[model samples]
Target: MSSIRAVLFDLDDTLWPIVPVIQRAEKLLYAWLKLHAAPVTERVTIESMRERRQQLMASDPVYQRDLRILRRTVLLEAFADAGLDTRLVDEAMEVFSKARNEVTPFADVLPALENLRSRVMLGSVSNGVADLDAIGIAHYFQASVAAHRIGCAKPDAAIFHAACDALGVAPAETLYVGDDPLLDVEGAQKAGLRAAWINRVEIGQDRVLPSHVTPDAVFGNLHQLEQWLKDNDPLTR
Candidate 1:
């Protein structure tokens, strides 16, 4: 086994449940639009906006990695459809971004990071647009790399390599922890990094990982991953 010297983490479902966060943010965004950009509400409902975003994402592969731009594009399109000023996209984005960053991480996340940092370099490899600084967990991470910043998302080796580069370590020297089997485990493996899947929601059978994409370990949460490292990994000891 390659001795782990660094740890990289996925942000969304790994640290916090992301669907609720996006739901709340989108709701707040529409409410904000109802107050300031009312015409958008008149022409666009939140559900329809989601469908439109999916359609846009299908048409533009770039948007799949760049959510900030995708959301802005959707806002512009919606405003244009309503014959309203396209300038409100920025303001609407701000509202959504603020809400998006209002995330409450898993209860075990802070403590696990604290424990792991004492033994190894810690970094964030996220595809989502969560601002660590705004989320008040920025101090825990030495390096933070995001897909939007890199113009590529997880399941792509380039973004993972970029993150390893940021931490001055070979991919094999880092253990990547995340929730998704494909994007996190498979991607990290492809990039030559060991992976641990944090299956907090326990979608065990439903998320049957392929034999080729099997993770190095399956953890119930960060705390379990942390404990397993201390108990088994030589570097952590």
Candidate 2:
């Protein structure tokens, strides 16, 4: 209910739809594999590669904690499995990483962000290994705290606290906006900050509200979010 001095965002699904972009990136990676790595190309299909990556990731708790390392680990294993050079994993990962950066944000994002930037300090707190600079949105944030850099992931209070620390603001004075109900909303609230749910998908689930975690406000998309910011009640509250 106080004036929000800063706003923290969740990357991936919050900023842009992650599923489609990842699918496209993987498709591209597989095409490259088929063309360049003949041994790997013959041994594994794209679906199998994805399955292997998931299985390998599940076996390692550390990999689950940091998505960047997880991605590199998966790529390395895939290369190793195909009897190809492991050293090429890094180069392949670079290509995939660039593909990841080529995301298109929701239509309302730029204008909303442009408007919000002048009013409050903007920063990011992500559980993944996305480099905002690679995505060309680095200038929009004052700080970006990722799990790999901080050595902890959300809904751990330490990670949330670190983001607030980086912004030089107390938890209560900040607003955390994210897509995941548990990880973003509940986690931020537990860390003593107000939270907002960017529920872009109308999944018809009321599970995130007033139960597991109660967000201060909820919006269906960035357009609604922009309108809310213009009204100022959500941010002021």
| Model number with the top TM-score | 1
**lDDT of candidate 2 over 110-157, digit per residue (tens):** 787787787788999998777788777889888899988878889999
Each model's total of backbone clashes: 0, 1
**Tens digits of per-residue lDDT for model 1, 1-237:** 778899899998888878889999999999999999888899989999889889988998888898998889889988998888888788899999999999888889889888888999999998889999999998888899998898989989998899899989999999999888899998999999999987785423236566777788998888888778888787797
Best by lDDT: 1
Candidate 2's error at 177, in angstroms? 0.6
What is the TM-score of each predicted model, taking all chains together? 0.95, 0.89
RMSD of candidates 1 onward, in order: 1.7, 2.6
lDDT of 1 at 62: 89
**Pairs with steric clashes in candidate 2:** 1-237
Candidate 2, which ten residues in sequence have the lowest lDDT sum? 201-210
Candidate 2's C-alpha runs over 4 A off are 202-210, 226-237
